[model samples]
Target: MTRVQANLLLLLAAAIWGGGFVAQSTAMKELSPFWFIGLRFAVATAAVLPFVLLERRKAAVKTSRRHLGLYLAIGLALFGGAATQQVGLQTTSVTNSSFITGLYVVFVPVIAVLFLRRPPHWIIWPGAVMAIAGIYLLSGGHLSALTVGDGLTVICAGFWAIQITLAGTTVKETGRPLALSATQFAITSLLALIVAAIFEPVSLDAIMGAAPEILYVGVFSSGVAFVLQIIGQRYTTPSQAAIFLSSEALFGSSLAALILGETIPPVGYIGCALMFSAMLVVEVVPELSRRRAQAV
Candidate 1:
């Protein structure tokens, strides 16, 4: 697919994820976080497993043990992010969880710079600062009284950043993006099930009651959207993909307002604007400069 097509797919994935927040938050009324998460990813694993097996048959090369290790690490990151966000949703507004999680766009570059020693363009610093200011505004213009859910969501964003960074490299190196996604889903589901079995009350009646939410989030959000992300990344740069995916925040907040009737304060809107602007600065400026240079 062309880059533009890939980006559009990413945007679709973002929209799916955006609405997924509602499913996740609503299901928590009837389910524990671990139980919900475990069941959701179990569905995701089942949804993606057939594709992974089909691809495995088509491709002669097998995944190495090293690649499996990488998949495990990626799965752990996914679990961290998903579990934290799930738990945070119990106490946080969907809008808050979404915007805070969207901070992963900012975290991605920082992670790249710090751990990978890759220097980002000059715009990254200003964008990061702007996003920080946005977070402050989103948090009622003060950082001192942030809620536990907010803090956990921030940690979720960090883990999401890790997962995003690893996904591209892992996919490229292994040449089995679909299988990798399926494996991660399996691992995350297993871990979540184990936790749910230990700490949370898991009941079939509850699962059946929340089946619609689970199916929507699991099949579409985890299975379809994740596959779209992997395919989208193959055709676009990580920077571009981040920008497109970051729209999940806006979509989430809007959906919450419309469906859940949750209203953000005016200041929170300003925060959203600032955060989105920061994302644009990071993604758009470089592309504009490159285009201008090409034209010249």
Candidate 2:
């Protein structure tokens, strides 16, 4: 649970999340966005419920109305981000979806500064600029290709940042992170179901057709990746966690190319490099300084 170990786990979580975009995009072909989200979160809730109950049994976890309210609020934010991102994916490429979603790293610090009144380090701005450029390249270089989906994904990133920040704030107060996660998923599933009932054509056929992809996203991305994020962030700072998680875009783009026959233009690769370099500057350089100071 050292910082290095935590960071590595975050990287693995990002890789899983990266591959998840492919599953989500593919499933969208056979399912409506709300249906896919509902099913995915439903499965995620089921997967996490057992672990949550087990943890509750081992520990004296007390749940109050206030705590439930907090979890519900967090869940709503998560649901909004997921739903919008899925809708965006319907019209956007996986690469575009991921790169734009990855903007949460930038958004988190900005939100921290603006809403939470937390001042960010000087490095955050430069890192954000680098990530923006990287996203542009990752989106195939021409800003003209940006669509409403891209805008929605950007908004999704902001919501996700808020969710992450809120989750970090509440995790310490809640004894059962797993249970909280389960509750969040359950709430999200319920909300998605409501949305599906009204807007989406949620039939059994669509669910069955998208079953495999939904299972992958639910089990690996939502269930497992989220748990890892909670655990890993316990040992890392939010900014550091953001840097590690941002790797999802890089991993997603590469996975899409290999698995989905998607290819990024050369300029896109350069953009990815620039974005990654900026993250390294933000995260790695501080650690290097600490190590050097320790050596002296």
Candidate 3:
């Protein structure tokens, strides 16, 4: 796929994830965070398993130990981010949670440069900062309402950055986005199910009560969107992927206002504008500079 196509996939993933924030928040009324995450990813695993097996059938290369290790690492990061965000949603507004989670845009570029030694275009740094400020505005200047959940979501952003970075590398290397998705989904499910079994009340009724949300997030958010992320990253840099994905904050807050009846302050509209501008700049600036230099 072309870079533009890949970025569009990432943008679609962000939109799906934006709605996921609403499902996650509402489901907690009937389910605990661990129970929700467990069952959700359990469904995601089942949803993607068939595709993964088919992918293996088509590709003759056997899975390597290194690939398994990388998949495990990505799964662990996914679990950490999901757990923290879910638990954080219990105490925070969905808008607040999403805004804080958008911090991963900054973290992704930073991690790429610091650890992976991959530097993004200079625009990424400023764009990331702009996105953060916009995300903060999306919270409608309500960050002062931050609870413990907000703190956890902040940590969740770091885990998301780790997952995004690792998934980018692993998919580029293995060219097995389906297999990666299934593995990470299964691992996350198993770990969450174990935790749910131990500490949380995992009842059939609770599962049934939150069934709609479980299915939505599992099927679309975890299964489809994550797969898109893996596939899309193969054709795009992690930093640019992050800029696109971070628009989830904008989408989430808008969804919250419409579905959850949450109010967005006037400043929140300004935040939306800023967020869009950041994405546009990140996507267009480098290409424009390259063209101008060619002309010169």
Clashes of each: 0, 0, 0
lDDT for each candidate structure: 0.88, 0.83, 0.85
Listing every candidate in turn, what is its Cα RMSD in Å to the true structure after a full C-alpha superposition? 2.4, 3.0, 3.6
In candidate 2, list every pair of residues with a backbone clash: none
Kindly report which residue pairs in candidate 1 clash with one another. none
For model 3, give the 10-residue run with minimal summed lDDT.
138-147
lDDT tens readout by residue for model 3, 1-296? 99999999999999999999999999999999999998999899998988888888787567799999999999999999999999999887887777778767557767888888987879897888787777677667677744788789979989998998999899778878788888888888899989988998767888899999999999999788977887898898755785788788878888998999977578977876776677567666777787779999
Poorly placed runs, candidate 2 (over 4 Å): 1-11, 58-61, 229-244, 279-296
Candidate 2: lDDT over CA atoms? 0.83
Report the C-alpha displacement of residue 173, candidate 3, in angstroms: 1.6
Give TM per candidate. Answer: 0.91, 0.87, 0.83
After superposition of all CA atoms, the RMSD between model 3 and the true structure is 3.6
TM-score of 2: 0.87
lDDT of 1 by residue, 252-272 (tens): 999999999998667888998
| Candidate 3 structure lDDT | 0.85
User: What C-alpha lDDT, on a 0 to 100 scale, does residue 127 get in candidate 1?
Assistant: 89
